[model samples]
Target: MIKHDVSHFPTILVFNTTEKDKTSVALIKNGSVKISEKSRRAQELQSIVEELIDNNHIEIGEIKAVAVLEGPGSYTGIRIGATTGNTLHWLYRMPVIVIPGTDISEAAERLMSGEEFDVTTYFSPRD
Candidate 1:
């Protein structure tokens, strides 16, 4: 098996707003889940992220990449997650991963394995 250099992705922030009521956020570090939270509402996404990181004593600068689920679910939710991830990428110049499915752990693993994703700034989920 080939080994991948995932040193650059020490910490990854993940957003999964594909499910309307189950919107969630996670922080993956060294291929382990440091924190995971389900947002009570769509508007809570930002606060959820902040709370998770703050509680885990993780600083924003420690995050090397951002992963967001590019939905087959709620359009509004997809927009929220995608917009947040894209905005972070633009601000921090970090890689933004667009996941096409619901498996957050799988996506994180792919990143840890040095898999590349095509990230786009705009998102328009099917209604």
Candidate 2:
């Protein structure tokens, strides 16, 4: 298990794609939203996140965890967000926390408590 002490590393990369037409990416620090960007271009999600990180001068490693807002919104958007979060988890070995709603504080609490969720298991498209 990874140590997710927010005080040690307060930066958390958040992805909120629960909206029908737009995707939101944010840098969260110390339980507060630091910087954020929204895009209607769902296909540009990856680039948007990259640019946001770059613009904020936040390194990938500096992010304590990846918090993804899972569903109750756009299907495709949710898929994209989860996939990106999972990819980041795999590539960088960062912990991925799935937020069922838009609550960032709740996710932070879960992280602090060391409650782990399988990021990949949350998204399964209904056929």
Candidate 3:
């Protein structure tokens, strides 16, 4: 469930932990990107989020949504990402958009549109 907030700057927190032992987070604020990814995803997820948020000067009220990569990939990675997104949803009462993880391109396209990609095969419905 997403609560509408007109008082704050709308920002999306996008994260993908679909690959094994690799995690990445992207905080999209005002067309600026604060992102980090490494093999240390598990150990660094929280810190990465903090760094992105702090560096971007995002307040709790500024977060409009959290978009996370839902998986056809690593179970642990998906679980961790889901957990973090859920935590954010609980804390902020913002909507959590679960993006299908078949390709990062779709999510990226949705986040910011300028350049375009050729369409590929459509994915199945989420299980």
Candidate 4:
């Protein structure tokens, strides 16, 4: 249970399952990342959600929106994360925003440099 003060911002839940090393679920508030959990197994999805819920990191009703990584990579991983996000959005009547995995890198680059940058990123299949 990791706790941080994010009371001034809208809570956004983000799930990324595009690549193994980069797979993660994060909570963002006021333009800063708050809580983040990363894992490789698809099975860890439930635990990740439970961890967020159990810790009171995000209140169900207070979730402003949900963001999911819509991928051109792991089909199963993307589906798992999307399903979770969709279910939550439907259950709580929150808006769901789908962001492609590639865009996330681009966004990070823009944020850091304050300028647009071009970069290539992808996920390779497991043996």
Candidate 5:
């Protein structure tokens, strides 16, 4: 039995696959983003996680859930982030939540407007 003392605030791991040139993962604790980073390759993802853990002084076991960008972007980027999130979830028994990048943008728009707005997202491969 592993004992984890996750703070009562929400903790989220956000991944972005919106652009091939830019991939990012963010760690949010208590509604505050503690760490955010970008990497280009799958091999670099783990290192970013390690850096976040080290820099934020957080334990891997302390993460309560993972919030990953589900896609409509680079397939390989999504796979990399999803694989990493899933692995962590399996190892720590934490919850995994997925949010599309469009949804995030829509939410931001709604917050800014204080009114509901129709939102649509499209993705196309880069040639």
Candidate 6:
């Protein structure tokens, strides 16, 4: 439901560990992507992120943006995940986008079922 220019950033880092019960981490670049949702997100978040990028052979500098599934979940987890994206933005000088989590699940489900998914714009705090 938030809007901003996403064209400036091609590669995106997605964070979805807002829910304590269900969590995931994803890294996306062009047509290559990796995602994991095997639980213990707190312990696996960092490593998954590293491995996702590493396995994909994407350099850290190539990540042009970050997207976070924000809210409607564990408060502490959301803050921690969002904070990580914020830190990335601060270090990389790219945009950090915060999106509503409620719809993200539905979108993901649809995608898994080979259904159409609407491409929505993202919102950045710096804007």
* Top lDDT model: 1
Show model 5 residue runs off by greater than 4 Å: 1-9, 102-127
Point out where model 6 deviates above 4 Å.
102-127
Per-model CA lDDT versus the true structure: 0.73, 0.66, 0.64, 0.56, 0.56, 0.62
TM-score of 4: 0.64
Identify the superior model by lDDT, candidate 1 or candidate 3. Answer: 1
- Model 6 lDDT tens row, 1-127: 4355453445777777766765676665554456766566544567767877888887989988777776677776777676777777777776766666634444233233433222233333233
**Model 3: per-residue Cα lDDT at residue 49:** 79
Model 4 lDDT tens row, 39-126 = 5565587677567656765566777666666667777777776777777766776555555453444432222333322211221222
Look at candidate 5 and tell me the lDDT of residue 73: 70
Pairs of residues clashing in candidate 2: none
Q: Which candidate model has the greater TM-score, 3 or 4?
A: 3
TM-score of every prediction relative to native: 0.80, 0.71, 0.72, 0.64, 0.67, 0.72
Query: lDDT of candidate 6?
Result: 0.62
lDDT of 3 at 10: 48
Tell me how many residue pairs clash in candidate 2: 0
Q: State the TM-score for model 1.
A: 0.80
